[model samples]
Target: MEKVKVDLVVTGYVFNDKKEFLLIYHNKLNKWLPVGGHMEQNETPDEALLREVSEETGLSVEILGKSEIGMGGNVKTNLATPFHVNVHNVGDHDHCSLFYVCKAKGSGEIKLQEEEVGGFKWVKKEDLNQEFIPKDVRNIALKAFETVE
Candidate 1:
């Protein structure tokens, strides 16, 4: 049996009031995907997600959903819950990804990080069905739209 290496990854489905969600064309993966990346050591999934989104798309987003518990005693803060979670293959390895729903907070202009992202688009729910989008991405995107709208 092949050794399966699973990494912790985080992604966000960032939506706007216009009912559009953001998608990035990843340079390495060569696929349309949400803004996210592998979690760094000693970082929480939520922190990693926010950092990744900022680095990849340059959009300031507020993660949707909230924690019921308040921070106290050792716990500095409570993180938002992910709307969806899944394990998917990324060629040589696999990613156990946490998916969060978010909304743009300000101007929402995207400045792509060319080293990681090839391009970006704010797509409508209907756009998910396009042939260029992988089925998993389409399904998750639709779910994000459903959650937001």
Candidate 2:
């Protein structure tokens, strides 16, 4: 049976100290995009961001923004605020994606998940103007860079 469900996904615009952004060439999608994936059960968005970033690039990152929300009484959990949210179609299903800005913890080699990504690169802000990059991703990436500056 075909699964028709709206999946919650997270994306990160990860920048290094040099202010370059990390992008991955998704083998399945055949496009260059930020690192992210579907949120796992029982995991907060911040936790899922860390997990996805580590799994995809092998680099530890500090997600930028508030990592907690006060919901009145004694309930508090670390949940990074998404810089942007939008829904997009993914073949048979849809993905409601939360986009975040992040910074690499330290300098390190990026190890790609060969099965998922064809390649990866650290792109400068100017390079974001390239035609290959989607307009929305480019816009958000530019905003992320500006926010950190």
Compared with the true structure, all predictions reach lDDT values of 0.88, 0.88
Steric clash pairs (candidate 2): none
> Which pairs in model 1 have colliding backbones?
none
- Residue-level lDDT of model 1, residues 128-148, one tens digit each, is 788888888888888788777
Candidate 1: where is the Cα deviation over 4 Å?
A: 71-74
After aligning candidate 1 to the native by TM-score, how far in Å is the CA of 52 from where it should be?
0.4
Global Cα lDDT for candidate 1: 0.88
Best by TM-score: 1
Tens digits of per-residue lDDT for model 2, 36-80: 999999998889999999999999999888745557667675567
TM-scores vs. true structure, each candidate: 0.93, 0.90
Residue 97, model 2: Cα distance from true site in angstroms:
0.4
